[model samples]
Target: MKSEETPFEGGPMDGRSLPVLVGPTGNPPKTYRIPVPDDAGGPPTVLVYRRVPRAHSKRLGLPKGWKYEFDPEGKRGGGPRWPWSKPDPAPDATPGGKPDDTHG
Candidate 1:
């Protein structure tokens, strides 16, 4: 007898599953399906969907260190506005130059 080449050849995903649609408050959003890894046991992962509304909206329950802004035309202006300012660089680094090692 010959062995199967692929793991999904005769597995649970034998063509009985369907795609799922995910989105926020809007008429048209994104759609995708959950992927099944080759190995049954693996590290966990998460998927996030970002949407830009035409008008002002409430905040979302995003994870820590995650940020989002609403832009009608999706343009990058002025450096960064409130709620999304740039973080300070390392202490040994210059304003626009390379870093300096004094303690090393």
Candidate 2:
């Protein structure tokens, strides 16, 4: 697991650099989440940051690096709930948790 020193912009994480873990493709996760502890002992608040291009080469227009930008929305379930992105729910499971076999 390789990491890169990534910079963040805007929100509470503005102008901060942190080492982010990159995947096998040598790219960091699209979304970075940070959980801040609640002073009142409630659920922690999560801050979301979205990945974006830091700069592009003027000659060939290739991306130079990546950075994280604060997402104001920062809400849960922010991404598209596309059918392909998620596994389809079982529509015919019996009460015992086995699939109904009459159709099969």
User: Which structure among the candidates has the greatest lDDT?
Assistant: 2
TM-score per model over all chains: 0.20, 0.72
C-alpha RMSD for every candidate: 16.4, 7.9
lDDT of 1 by residue, 1-104 (tens): 22212111113333232222333531323211234454658854322222223244348643222112222343334444667777556677676785677888
What tens digits encode model 2's per-residue C-alpha lDDT throughout 6-52?
99999999999999999998889989999999999999999999999
Q: Give stretches of model 1 more than 4 Å off.
A: 1-39, 54-104
Clashes of each: 0, 0
In candidate 2, residue 22 scores what lDDT? 96
Residue pairs that clash (backbone atoms under 3 angstroms), model 1: none
Model 2's C-alpha root-mean-square deviation from the true structure amounts to 7.9
- Candidate topping TM-score: 2
